[model samples]
Target: MTGKSEHDDSEREFDYRWARDAPHKEPSARARMLAARWKENPPEPVPFRGEPEASGPRRSSWISTALVLGCVAAIILLLGYTRFQAPY
Candidate 1:
């Protein structure tokens, strides 16, 4: 095999001459008509409807929060007590 590695060979060059030399195409008749119509009469902006405000003051129920915390504490205490009494 040749002592030179694959990377040693020159990289292939890309031909961008076609893009630089290509002619620009004109817009179609239908496309032109639509563009003219859009320019003459544009659509109206939709009305923004904000969310309705709550009837009463938004406050968390203290009773519900306290109950949830109590349940979590009781679960932790029960688990700890069971682990302490577990057989060695």
Candidate 2:
């Protein structure tokens, strides 16, 4: 009888499950995480520059050489000089 009465104490506590039914107002996981990050720090807006920031000079010096060489070849071909090998 003593053992059975001792175990009944666990179940005798008042439950407030009905109190939680008022609104169940709680932030969602995302909202909670966002709030925690906001509290820890502050919100920062993303930069929206009109033109995308260039990483660096994308064109290499060799590309300029190739372009100049192509123009020279065009001028040479237009001058009616026949080459041993076809331009193609």
Candidate 3:
């Protein structure tokens, strides 16, 4: 059996119920003052600056194509030169 007595269990249950049903307290003076001030003069929304538009023409795809073709050509030429120079 558990060590706790029936009295202790009832006391804990009563405390829990009391805390759960507790009344809500009134707002503090500072909170009420700020709320009143906001009601009197609500703040205006500040306008955000939009992103800048693209100023110049976009780069062409041919530049990247040419770069890849040049790399492949260089690799091919290097392999050919090495194969010829290697002694049998």
Candidate 4:
């Protein structure tokens, strides 16, 4: 029968505390090589939805305006249909 202690005597206790005051070791050779490689060849920018980003915002605002108008028209139609078709 085990006694009312947290851990058994034979069991090794794992230290979960971070050693904040411990000396920082130099980066490993592999880490240094990776850093150097990254410095030489940086990662390319991710493609925007499989397409390159526009160099400038040369796109006209008319498309967005038309979309907004279409949404408003749909909402008006829905409201009108619901109001007029009510079984009062």
Per-residue error for 68 in candidate 3, Å, reads 0.3
Order by lDDT, highest first: 3, 2, 1, 4
What lDDT does the true structure give each of the candidates? Answer: 0.79, 0.81, 0.83, 0.78
Q: Compared with the true structure, what per-residue lDDT tens digits does model 2 show for residues 1-80?
A: 99888779867865578557757677789999998999989887766766677898688899999999999999988776
* Cα lDDT tens digits for candidate 3, 1-88: 3656876786666565566577975688998998999899987675697667898986689998999999999999999999999999
> Which candidate number maximizes TM-score?
4
Top-lDDT candidate index:
3
Clashing pairs in 4: none
Which portions of model 4 miss their true places by more than 4 Å?
1-18, 25-33, 36-58
TM-score for each predicted model, relative to the true structure = 0.33, 0.27, 0.35, 0.42
Candidate 3 has what TM-score? 0.35
Runs with alpha carbons beyond 4 Å of true place in candidate 2: 1-56, 81-88
Looking at model 1, how many pairs of residues clash? 0
Error of 4 at 4 (Å): 12
How far is 9's C-alpha from truth in model 1 (Å)? 51
Superposition-based RMSD of candidate 4 using all C-alpha atoms, in angstroms = 6.5
